[model samples]
Target: RLERLGARFEAASPLGNGQCSAPHPLTVTALADGVALEPAATLNCRAAEALARWTTEVQVAAQKEFGESLKSLALGGTYVCRGQNHDTDAKLSEHSFANAIDVMAYGFTKRASLKVTAAPDGTPEAAFLASARTGACTFFRTVLGPGSDAAHGNHLHLDLRERNAGHRLCQ
Candidate 1:
């Protein structure tokens, strides 16, 4: 199913530390219909699946908003052993378990790449970004982007962090 969605990847060595781990990780190189992931990403299957699904929606939004196809994604990071928000004292981040990704920007086939930051309120980029962020909530349990907080001011933080009662956090 993931292959049909255009996700190109290979099995990766398991990731682990005393505090965090992912038993079966994968290195994802591309997503939905050839959209590349710059520098690729190491993720657990569930997180990779969510990213593929969300990318499919973002591809459609790009065509509708700019009449162009998405080319690549500038990823900040995927799997890392770190605490939430990089605060060592905080709880372990989803990234620690290869369950999260930070998207820094989106590249298009023709239009200039769009960074995940605050854009002019009425611009096409802003609208497209808004649509992309909102659509991510359908696939990811947690979606944090610009204006969510100081820690997430410049990138979209997406994760499959489960919560009580199936609650979702879309900030």
Candidate 2:
């Protein structure tokens, strides 16, 4: 599906893990749906697909609501070999397995980018951000944003973590 949509990516070698590894890792540099990434990202195919879908949906929504098309996706990072909150003793984060992405901002075609922030009071950009966060819940297993926690204060954390009984964490 991602290939059909014009996403440019390459398969990566398996990475480290005692429990599991991303056998099908991918480095995505561009999206066919017209969304751009601030920096190229590497992720599991599933995570990449979900991000592409979410970006497309969010861009369309923003166009309808704010009359602006998305120019680029500001990413914090991806495919990090780290534990939750970078605590070595803590459980491994989805990022360690290439199953997560951190979005920092959304650049628009017509105006300035809308950065993710805790102080998303009442504004059109805030509303757009809220809508993107809410809509992302449908595609990702976890969606952590501004109010989720101090650790995720400035960026949106999206991941495809498997949960019991199909339960999802969307905060």
Candidate 3:
């Protein structure tokens, strides 16, 4: 499926540290049509698939909002062994299992890049970001970004954390 989406990636070594693990991990460098993931991303296949699917929506939103194609994604992180929100006593984060991605910014083919910070109201960047965040809920079980919390104010935190009764958290 990833190949069908034109995503360039390769299988990675199994990852784990007792508390967190990914049996089948992947390192993705690009999405559809050469849309790069800046610095690439290390993720479980399920998370990578969700990202691949969401990129289509992002491309559409970019075209509609800025009349430009997406060039690259400035990613903040993919897999990290840490507690949620960096609190040592909190539950382990989806990133701890290679099942989450932090997106820091969006790069365009013909427009200035837009960071995932608060954009002015009514601006194209704001609308584009809103569209991206909302669209992500369709693919990711958890979609957190600016306004969700101070910890997530500068990046979109997407994850595939399962929940009771198929509930989703899109904040």
Candidate 4:
């Protein structure tokens, strides 16, 4: 049986941090059953459909642009504290609920790889990130790579939640 990871969104709180209006936290849960399954997020049910669609697109793009040699995908950022750039109030993370995804690794089997913070910065890492960002996959509504921000120096922040419906502040 195939399983689609489902995530749920929880409104951001101000108790931890003064910022909570950004992407809400997500609560992801796994379901096991017998059925032809498809990958899915636990974001808003409506948004989940979109997220699932986009995720597949990103995978395809990665393979097509990077290579069929690509293996497991690495993650960096996911659900985090929603706020303006660099604004933190010591609150819970936006991913506290599971609304976000941080890409940190991408291995081509146990051999070739493209993992953020996995290998020291060099020509290989540079090329990996460059290709992923420029590949133009429609899976993630937004893709934040190195140079996007210092905090993102080692990974790509992939959010599959509602954007513009409110706004996208991730980088």
Candidate 5:
């Protein structure tokens, strides 16, 4: 599906903790003439389903905001980290169950990382990050941005937290 749309895909780290079937979202980038998918740990059934929904929404939002200019997605893949915003005790995060995807970073260089949330002033990175935030609210339940805390400074936290649980945070 991605290739047909000129998307590039790559498999990244796989689960090693011997937990579930290596559940985590495959980080992807869909551009105007090419797409990139960095396959990460592994995604559980629920998260996988949620990602599908999120992907669709992201595409529409990018086009709506950029107009035929599919913003370059640069954040390779979701990191399967031990939970906790910041702490060694950050045990298996929701991502361990493939319930979360950390958008480490994105690329608006070819375009413009909109000014929103952390940026708001229209810095290049900020603008790109903004589009992700602006468009993805409906796809994933929890969206955490830079001001969300030190742990999330460089990434957009997107999680499939059902029941509207946890912090519906946007930093």
Candidate 6:
């Protein structure tokens, strides 16, 4: 289904066990619909689907707002078997289960890439980032970005963790 939708990916072998494990993993290298992820990323099927949709949907709006179409996504990484913020003693993060992706920047075809940050005070670029962050809540169960926390001060963290009552964490 994903391949038919123009998602370029390859299935990954299951990893780990017990508290830190990822099932049905996939290494998605690109979204053939026009969005390219820098260095690619690995994620679970559901997370990958949500990412593709979010990028596709946001790219149109981003282009209209910024006068430039997005061409690539700069990712911090995905599918790391670690606890939140890499705290070994802490609970595992959604990334540990291949259910999350960290977006550090956005590349445009006609302009320099936009770095995800809380600095520079106010600017059209910041506005666009805000809009994109808010828009992500529609597709991801958890959306953490710049102002969310120090750990997420430089990247947007999106995940597909199911919650009761369709609860969502958008910060």
- Cα lDDT computed for each candidate against the true fold: 0.95, 0.86, 0.96, 0.46, 0.53, 0.85
Candidate 6 residue-wise lDDT, 1-171, digit = tens: 677667889988887767767777888988845678788788889899899888877787677778778888999978888888889899789998989999999888888888888745477776788788988999999999888888999999999888899999999
TM-score on alpha carbons, each prediction: 0.98, 0.93, 0.98, 0.50, 0.61, 0.92
Q: Candidate 1: minimum summed lDDT over ten consecutive residues — where?
A: 1-10
Ranking by lDDT: 3, 1, 2, 6, 5, 4
| RMSD values, in order shown | 0.7, 1.6, 0.6, 7.3, 5.0, 1.7
Worst 10 residues of 2 by lDDT: 14-23
Q: Deviation in angstroms for 124 in model 3?
A: 0.7
Q: Which wins on TM-score, candidate 3 or candidate 6?
A: 3
Better of 3 and 5 by lDDT: 3
- Model 3 CA deviation exceeding 4 Å by range: none
Instruction: Report residue 107 deviation for candidate 4 (angstroms).
Output: 1.3
- Model 3's C-alpha root-mean-square deviation from the true structure amounts to 0.6
lDDT of 2: 0.86
**Most lDDT-accurate candidate:** 3
lDDT of 3: 0.96
Error of 3 at 32 (Å): 0.1
Selected candidate, larger TM-score, 2 vs 3: 3
Better of 5 and 6 by TM-score: 6
Q: Provide backbone clash counts, one per model.
A: 0, 0, 0, 24, 23, 0
- After TM-score superposition, what is the CA distance of residue 50 in candidate 5 from its true location, in Å? 2.5
- Clash pairs (backbone) in predicted model 6: none
- Candidate 5 error regions (>4 Å): 1-34, 39-41, 76-81, 107-117, 120-128, 163-171
